[model samples]
Target chain A: MKEKEQMKNKTGYIMLLIVLGLYGILYFVHAGKTLQALEATFGVFKTVAPILLVVFFLMAFLNTFIDEKSVAKHLGDDSGFKGWFIALFGGVLSHGPGYIWYPMLQELRKKGALDGLIVAFLYARSIKLPWLPLMISYFGLTFTVVLTFYVLVGAFVQGIFAGKIMNEAKKDR
Target chain B: MPRNVQRLKETSLQTFKTLQSIAPMLFAVMGLVGIFETFVTPEMIHKIFNAHAIHDMLLATTAGAVSVGQPFLSYIIGGELLDEGISMYAVTAFILSFVTLGIIQIPLEFSIFGARFTIVRNLLSFLFAIVIAYMTTLSTSFLSGYFS
Candidate 1:
């Protein structure tokens, strides 16, 4: 197990180095365009990255505070409506690029978040905040109402189905 | 209760350890993204999305698939789309996919969840992204009592 982890770490590091090296080359090759892009990207990171980092840290810290047993006690399979609602809301409320959220979601699953709930959250991410206003401005009240209702409903249905399928599949395993 | 304190301490330590383990890679990736950001341009993005309806949606999805950006970037691009007379559907598709999908991380996802599962999930997400955007537009139009 120790050797396996060491191997994974080495592979991860190599991948990181390769990616970094490529970016370095790109940055230098088209310094002018790259600088503009970098400024825009940095402009983006300045606002979003700090919030994401804080969330990541809080999640990491919180995950440790709640063991599988406790998570199971609160959010386990049979916890029913309340548990499901929490999972769904938690998933919807969480933010970040989907890539960044992947590891955290994996951690949540390990900590006993139901498969359906996880799926629901992933689905809910498709909904955006700024778009809500734009959506309201463009689409208006009735359509927005129905659409929001449909998304929330779809998220729940998808989550539950995903959970069921995974469990069933796991049983065969 | 005493047991709970011990568990809490153990969990805290584990959390710290995991963050410590991943911190280097995380910072490295963020730094790379910062570096890459310096290179993008509106014309570059415009070239990627163009103006054809079907092509624009495909381009939006494809762009959303490859790039990572904050919600603000989506709004900025969205405003540009409106100004440029790009279809609302296309812009919406791009925004939806931008946050929910990752084209560049397919390999990583494949490694973590097996290729078959990862591909199917993303394919499903991408398909649903269009639907969600369409619905958002349709609803927005209905609520405003005007075609948008």
Candidate 2:
């Protein structure tokens, strides 16, 4: 057993080395351009990272404070109109790249939140930031409004479909 | 009143137990990401995605797998690529996949949702991104011709 554990550790290290080696080769060839990209990336990370870290900790704390059953009681499928509003608002209020929220979302799903609410959140990210004037200037008002409406509507539709599909999938499981 | 207080205590205990269960996995991943970022170089990224239109979309989707960042950052990069004459299709695919699918987060997803569900969801999301991006580009072109 001890030998097996050492072999696994050795294999993991070897995999890491291979990945890093490829990156090194690519890095040398494009060092100058890549540095410029890294500089720009670091600049943006400076602003977004701290804010995201704060939100992560706060949400984690809230997970501790609020009982999942209570949240489900208020926000679950049977909550009707109020529940839908909660879903929409929750989606709109959710910040960051949606991918990063996946883990937390998985947690929420386990807590009994409906698929509709999850879809609402995903679609809400399409709604541009409050500085909508930039979007208006680029895409025009009609395009902006139509797309936002479509996204909001599409989200709920997708949620409903996903709910059915996921349920079926679960039944098979 | 005493019964109510006892019930509340039980609920609190359950919440704490749940939080404790997930905390280590969460922090461990975060710590690993912090270390990994220190060594990544930008050229390594560009070479992986710098190609022609369809190929670039594939590259972008693949790049998105191992890459981690915010959506706003994707928009910024997409805007820059747009200025550099990259195809709208490529940018759209990159931005979409950048937000919806994650390569680096797979470990965490597996831990949370189980490996099978995580793999299925990510695969579905990736393929859907390609379709959505292609449609978005086509629609934009169609609309532009009509509106112009």
Q: Pick the candidate with the highest TM-score.
A: 1
Query: Model 1, A1-173: lDDT tens per residue?
Result: 56644654565577678766776777678766656655655575576566666656676566646578877766678768877677667656766555556556667777887766666777776556545776566534565566567567767776676677677777898
The sequence of per-residue lDDT tens digits that candidate 1 reaches over residues B6-67 is 86677667655555555445544555555545544445776776688778887887777666
TM-scores of the candidates are 0.77, 0.64
lDDT of 2 by residue, A55-121 (tens): 4554554465556786687667676777767776766666654544654565577778765566556
Instruction: Give each model's clash number.
Output: 18, 2
Give me the overall lDDT of model 2.
Answer: 0.58
Query: What's model 1's overall lDDT?
Result: 0.65
Off by over 4 Å in 1: A1-4, A32-65, A95-101, A126-150, A168-172, B1-6, B49-53, B105-117, B146-148
Native A-B contact fraction in model 2: 0.03
TM-scores of chain B alone in all candidate structures, in the order given: 0.78, 0.84
Output the number of the lDDT-best candidate.
1
